[model samples]
Target: MQEDSPLTEATSDSRGASLLTSREPSPSDHSGRGTSRRSKITRKSHRKSRAGCVNCKSRRIKCDEGKPSCANCKRRQVRCEYPANPATSAAASGLVDPREPGDLPISEIELTYHWATTTCHSFSAWPAGVARVQALTEEVAMKNQHVLHLIFAFTALHLAVCRPKRKEHYTTTADYHYERALALVTPEIASLSPDNCDAVLQSVQMICFVSWARGPQAGEYLAFGKHGRSDWLVMFRGIRTTLASLSRDHFSKTHGPNTRGKGRLLPPSDGPFEYEKQLMELKEHIEFVSEPADRDDNVNSVEVLQEMYSNRYGGKDGEYHVAFGWLYRMSEDFLDRLQRCDPLPLIIYAHFVVLMHDLEKFWYMKGWTHHVMSGIYEALPIEHKAYISWPMARVGWIAP
Candidate 1:
């Protein structure tokens, strides 16, 4: 190679200087000035953040330190909690006293007991298995985060619905615990273990209750609107899928020895139950009525009304399928009318509430039937009162 070019020589010298600076300071270079300058530059380049909300800190992002909520969390719509300052923050927020029992907060314990006694009994629809909810509540709920959060969420929702004066406070508390349980349990939904299976199933059930509790008119109507109906269906489907997974796993474990070495086994199919047949009929009726040319408003309306009662007491599985099924099967125009609290739709909905009474085995539906019926009664006009007489009689409401 020819004599090194000035540019190449300069590059090599700079690389050597970079290498020297990266290494620990050597005694030969220790005027202390070079080391101090390098350290200062390094510190400036890799400064550690000393203040920010916990969410921003955990995410390793810069925070604008907004009060109540930081900019980062506001953008993401996540809870922004700051690190507790022993001096000022704790006192301002009315932090729980350290002397209070730490095992379970007194308020939480009270809510759990309330759920066990009142809420548990209300949702247990099956007569023979009613005690199971109470057993699970007492045995597993206290120690399990998923179940505990569900209990708190349910209790708060119940209070919110039953005690309107304190609805906001109870709703806020319910949302907090619901979010916590959802965050913890969502990841494990796909890979449920035997240890967590029961909690997951129970959480699904409680989540269903939460959905119902927050439903249209505070769990009164079938929540037929687009926003409420789709969300409720999603949660209902989640419960169905989770239950199916649990059943499949249990079957696999039970038959594993006999089926050893068998390639991945498929789940055994149980044919549709009786209620499913009625559901199919209802769907067929809806399809017929929805046809452009074949649609007869008078005939279609009559057919739908009849089907509502045909599946009113939803075969053996309980009334939820039929109760919600009717709401789901209705045409968009009908649903819109229902959402607007129209008299005819309210009358129809009140009949569905009659079906709900038979589902009282479910705690969430205990007072719902009466509450919805009362709302219909209040909203129905005098001229339209005659139209709802049959439904009123069915729900045991004597018209004034």
Candidate 2:
């Protein structure tokens, strides 16, 4: 129970005054003001939590007793956990001991709840698509431990972005599950078949999402990693090689794809022409380069981007694939240059992500445009940085 604030204050001050006077305070002590005022005060009784979290109790605050993260701890951006209830201890006998801040005990249910309710809806832009993806993710994750881990990984990473105060906590959890998913998925990838295809494909998508969502470091631009390695690219080639052995049925779609192609192209003041103009100027910039091999590698990359825009992609199609599908279509040479931080390809990529405005609106793709574009703009030299101004403006980035 909370102490009576006014009474406690008056009694303490009166005793201190008495000690200074070498006697106890009387009715006239301290000008006789606090005793009468304190006597008029009445303490209110309020209910307290019976099972508050340890974090809340230590801080002498109230707790809503939210699982996984209590309201107070979530607000404070710290870990929230309750002391085991003696009454429920037997029921929790099977729960794993949480090894670290990220490793939550008996959290499969909590994280899965988050996955089914919130994170699952992030993949698809439309309602029907959302329902379909949600069903598929739940159905597939049920029979696969790795898929479940992937779901939890994706959910935790999303939480990290949404709750910045708990970033380290959720990031660590995301990283733990991401690694767990890789360990379990590796064996199945070696022997991919129709039976495991659905699970494997879902896992693949989650992995890619998590990687991209986590942002790229200086040594890692786009799919490239440290020492100029095609990190995510190589990972895909392996999965692609294995998937090629399967049939068209393994990769069936609920709906045929839609493309806001060049046929829907608008005028000079509108998007298609203006967007293509940036890409066209990109190719022209590479064309003026002194090195033939350098010009060819970068120009072909820009051409691939231009062609993708002109042919199958340009407008808002409400399809997430339309944004990054070119990654699969891009040449290995171009991808290598991207990994190496080539100024031309880097600038081209900045333009490419302008197509990602729709994607950024997606829950998973949220903040990706800002995160990636900021990196690209920083990586470019001052002279080459001018190349990305259109994209910078498009994404609302003002370069410093």
Candidate whose TM-score is highest: 2
In model 1, what is the error at residue 361, expressed in angstroms?
9.7
lDDT of 2 by residue, 1-400 (tens): 0122111122244322111111111111011112223466755434255567766786787766665666877775554556654324433342433233453334444565566567767776455566656665555665676877777788888887788887887876677677768989998988888778767877876777776667644555455555665455565554455556777476545311221222222222234457766777777877896277777767777777776666434443444555566676677777777777777778778878776654666666666677678778777788888788888888887866
Rate residue 51 of model 2 by lDDT: 61
- Candidate 1 residue lDDT tens string, 227-250: 344455456556556655655545
TM-score of 2: 0.62
Q: How many clashing pairs per prediction, in order?
A: 6, 0
Off by over 4 Å in 1: 1-104, 125-129, 161-164, 193-195, 217-224, 227-229, 246-354, 357-400
For all predicted structures, in order, the TM-scores are 0.47, 0.62
RMSD of 2: 18.3
Please report how far candidate 2 places residue 332 from its true position, in Å. Answer: 0.7
All candidates' lDDT scores? 0.53, 0.62
Q: What is the lDDT of residue 218 in candidate 2?
A: 55
Error of 2 at 145 (Å): 1.5
